[model samples]
Target: MRAALYFTPSRDSDLTLAAAEWLGRDPFTGESVVSDVSGSDGLVDAPRRYGFHGTLKAPFALADGKSLEQLEQAAAEFAASRCRFTVPELALGRLGSFFALVPARPCDALNAFAGDVVRHFEPFRAPLSDKDLERRRKSRLSPRQDALLCEWGYPYVFEEFRFHMTLTGSVPAEQFDDVEELLKTSFAAFTGKPLPIDALAVFVETEPGAAFQVQSRHLLVSAETEE
Candidate 1:
């Protein structure tokens, strides 16, 4: 099994429910949701398996001597010690042929938060297997990213990470605009709003080809309370 750290809205939040329905799966519930988009299942096939979330720490196997229970406790501790914040604005965007919800501008707080999560969990992450290393190498990576992959098991973290909640696999270049419009309309109620970043979730993939599901959620405590 592999585990990842992600940010997802509260289980019963309207945005969470809408995203689950649009993606056709709910990581929180481990159930399928019907979508109205034509070929919706096929369009979101890639992200559906992972459900609706933005990764903070990419997935990795547990390091030797680490137990899932221990990891859960550590994650909960991390969450409880950190303060919650909000993303000022979220907008629909196309990253190449894929679509996602991304912040309108870079936020230092968001970047620092993600970097902390990566570093905090590093000790518990097993090194990437050879096959996984080679698979990452297939993509042309910058010198820094290659180094990050070697050291952290995932290339997109820290400075290279751009928080995005993926919505589609890869649409054709010609279909990008249409897909974006479709998603914009579908997610109108949730898009361009201030999104809360109040909790961190641990998600687990039971096997190589299985869908990842939420194993637990940790609420962020107020910074004032930590004093």
Candidate 2:
């Protein structure tokens, strides 16, 4: 099994429902949703398997001497030690050939938070398999990214990380504008608002090719009270 740290809204939140509907899968309920957007099922085919989430730590199997219980405990401790905050705004944007919701401006706090997660749980992460490494290298990464991949098992971490809730897979250049507009319309209710980074979720993929599902959510405790 592989585990990932992700950012997802509370199970009952309106944002969760809306994003689930848009993506055609609800990680919370493990139910399939019929999307209203034309050709949305095809567009979201890749991301749907992972559900609606922004990756904090990319998925990896547990390392030798690691157990699921230990991972959960570590995640809870990590969450409790952190402070909650919100991103000022989010907007629909295209990243290369994919569409996603991205922060409208840079957030130092968010970057630090994500970087911390990547580092904290790394000890429990198993080394990437040769096949996985090869697949990542196929993307034609820069020297720095290749080095990060060798160290972190993922290319995008630390300075290279860009927080995005992927909404589609690789899209044809010709279809980009139409897809972007469709997503904008579909997600109008949730975009351009303060997005809370109040919780961290642990997602698990039980086996290869299985859809990832939320195993637990850990709330970020307020720093003021801790002090």
Candidate 3:
């Protein structure tokens, strides 16, 4: 099994509901959600398998002697140490041929928070296996990305990390406009709004090809509540 640290909104939040519907699966419950997007099940299958989330820590096997229970406890402590913050606005944007909700503008606080999550979980991550390394290399990574992959088990981290909640895998050039319009219409309620970064979720993949499911969620203490 492998576990990842990810940012997914509260189970009941509007964004979460919309994402579950659009992705056709809910990570929190491991249930299929119905949506009206044309060919949604097929169009989003790639991301649907992982559920709706932005990667904070890519999936990794636990380091020797580290247990899920231990990781959960450490995550809880980490969450407690953080104060809830927000991304001023999230806009629908294309990353290459894929579409995702991305921050409209960079936010230093969010970047710092993601960096901290990666570092804090480093000790719990087992070194990537040779097979894993080979697979990562197939992407033809740049020198810096290759170095980061060797050190962090993921090529994207710290400065290279770009937070994105993937909406679909690569869209066909001819269908891109239609799909983009469909996504915008479907997520119109929550896109381009301040997004709360209030919780961290532990998502687990039981086997190599299985879908990831939320194992637990830890909420950051709100400043008002902390006071």
TM-score list, all predictions: 0.96, 0.96, 0.97
List the RMSD of every prediction in angstroms: 1.2, 1.2, 1.0
lDDT of 3 at 221: 93
For residue 140, what is the lDDT in candidate 2?
Answer: 100
- Candidate 2, which segments miss by more than 4 Å at Cα? none
Number of clashing pairs per prediction, in order: 0, 0, 0
Which candidate number would show the highest TM-score if scored against the true structure?
3
Per-residue error for 189 in candidate 3, Å, reads 1.2
The lDDT of each candidate is 0.89, 0.90, 0.92
Candidates ranked, most accurate by lDDT first: 3, 2, 1
For model 2, how does the per-residue alpha-carbon lDDT over 1-227 read when each residue is reduced to its tens digit?
Answer: 99999999899998888888888899987889876768675778889899789999999999999988889899999999999989999888889899988999998888999999999999999999999999999999999999999999999999999999999999988888888888888889878988889899999999998999999999998767667
lDDT of 2 at 64: 99
Model 2 error, position 212 (Å)? 0.5
Best by the lDDT measure: 3
Instruction: Determine the backbone clash count of candidate 3.
Output: 0
For candidate 2, give the lDDT of residue 164: 96
